[model samples]
Target: GDQSWTCFLSADNFKGPIAYYIPETWSKIGKLFNYPFLYGRGLDARPGIMGGGAMEINTVPCFEATDAQGRVYSRIPKLQFPVDAQGRAYLVQDVAYYSKAALYDAVKSWRDGGPACSGRFNENGCFKPKLNTRTTRYSQAGKRIAGVERFFDTRIFEGNVWGLQWFTNDRSETGVFPRYFKDEGEERVVAAEAEVPAETNLLVQNFKLAKQGAPYTSPTVGAWANPGPKLGPFNVKLADGSVVTYSWYRFIDQPSFQQYRWSEEKKAKLQAFVEKLHASWSIDRDYMPPPTRGRLVALDPALLVTPPKGLEVGYVPIVTGQAAQ
Candidate 1:
């Protein structure tokens, strides 16, 4: 174990010049899935309400609108991570509609006398209160999020950071950080709308919506689409050198031209059919495989790793490497 200490910070509003003991061993790394995975969010862009004849995405006000409370949602807390479909990682914006809703609900709840404020203030006197008073984290009603899905891990500019939105030098020399949890000393608490986030507050509640993305859809599984066949969500790469995995919502291990003899007439017809299907699908383009000939590694279930007694399922005997079927 190791010992560490920072300046004791209670007077200035920060709960730390933190002091603590640390374990010698670092934890295992985790799978790199899509961060800020907004579960249950409708993938369709928010539609434009119209009084005219055209039905296009022209009328829906951007996520900056004042709510029932005087609190203005001027910015839809945009975040960016370097992950996307074309196997290219770049900074992108994600709006926490759910988080804003949770904040909105917490404000309403506080107005309803839900509970007292709970959280330590920060150096700037801004504290992101725990969301206990509102739909704490996840629920069916009000501004609260459904769960961790609503909460995404991202570099605040990683759109702004990536966009260089903060300070050119403040965020220079080193990367800033990500706010991923609701903390006040130790326990989690919700903040009322009346309370602004204190300077010391690191984590806050939030969510993602689909209107923030392109109106494009995913490809569908066809007779030609196969498990290892490449697909594009961001930029298409016939071949790339990055180490990654390739995961699809459904593996398209269907038959392709290989199953047929060389025939241009038949090939063109089949290609046309496949193209039509691509116009209306949105399968998840996850799973980056290790570099090789690009041949997929399928795992044989017969070799499934079983955990020893007392360990959680799939947590122990961690799934390592790609499947080599």
Candidate 2:
């Protein structure tokens, strides 16, 4: 079997961003892949199409912010957090493909003032501005763009914001792999293409043929159970026809914690408190605290002072010598 490499395609006029992979390198791979069909279906029937060579397209909405001064800023929404193979986290922005100047102007428009105008028309019937607020306008898709729940936060850039294609978000999920849910009224997962890699790798890495004398236990009940040693090595074929072998025991336990045993009501309260604390911080402030005197000085909200039943909270406050007076 010939190996195939999956590739993603993006264009402004695409109804759903189309993706196709090169199943056979020689069968019009270069021509079909590089065809410039701006606003029409492409390669409907082509040779060497493996499994139809077409994939489900995922769309991300593009946004434009305009001010009363006729200045406009545009951006394509992006995912902030995506982890790598080695478990290192990195910030990832969806493909913007905007020129440096355009990106900077867009960010600047959102930061200085929003896209709304606060002034009234003058005697000449010309629109005059007492103030200009940048207003956001979405593409034809309306509010829900790219599965993003909220509009882009200009404050994420802080004061030193630039036109670069990269940024960060504190609200992003912590792992490289995202969690998926079953589709409504369907037992199958919604995004099989995205989940297949993670699910397959997880099964390969965790398959245990024998049970240990005692299952590894954690301090908290209902934590993930460790099923001792794995049976043997697992092999997966890569896109380039390379078979990579992975041993189960080679996978080490990454740092993790079980949720504190709290009632649903208490958990809701704690979540609300944390949200409020986050809101209290200045938007421009980075979520990560700067180290002071070789110590990380983090704010522990007063709501966390009392522990829930069967749980305890601990911290040591770093006091400055000057504050002692």
| Maximum-TM-score candidate | 1
How well does each candidate superpose onto the true structure, as a TM-score? Answer: 0.16, 0.15
Cα error, residue 114 of model 2, in Å, equals 43
Write the residue-wise lDDT of candidate 1 on 54-133 in tens digits.
21222222222333443333222333433334222223222111221323243334434565322122124222232111
Off by over 4 Å in 2: 1-155, 160-177, 185-325
Cα deviation at 125, candidate 2, in Å, is 33
**Candidate 2 on 179-261: residue-level lDDT in tens?**
22222221222122233233233213322343333322223223322322132233444443334332222012111212233
The models' CA-based lDDT, in order, is 0.27, 0.28
Candidate 1 overall Cα lDDT vs. reference? Answer: 0.27
Q: On a 0 to 100 scale, what is the lDDT of residue 241 in model 2?
A: 37
CA deviation > 4 Å runs, candidate 1: 1-164, 167-176, 179-325
State how far residue 74 of model 1 sits from its true place (Å).
Answer: 27
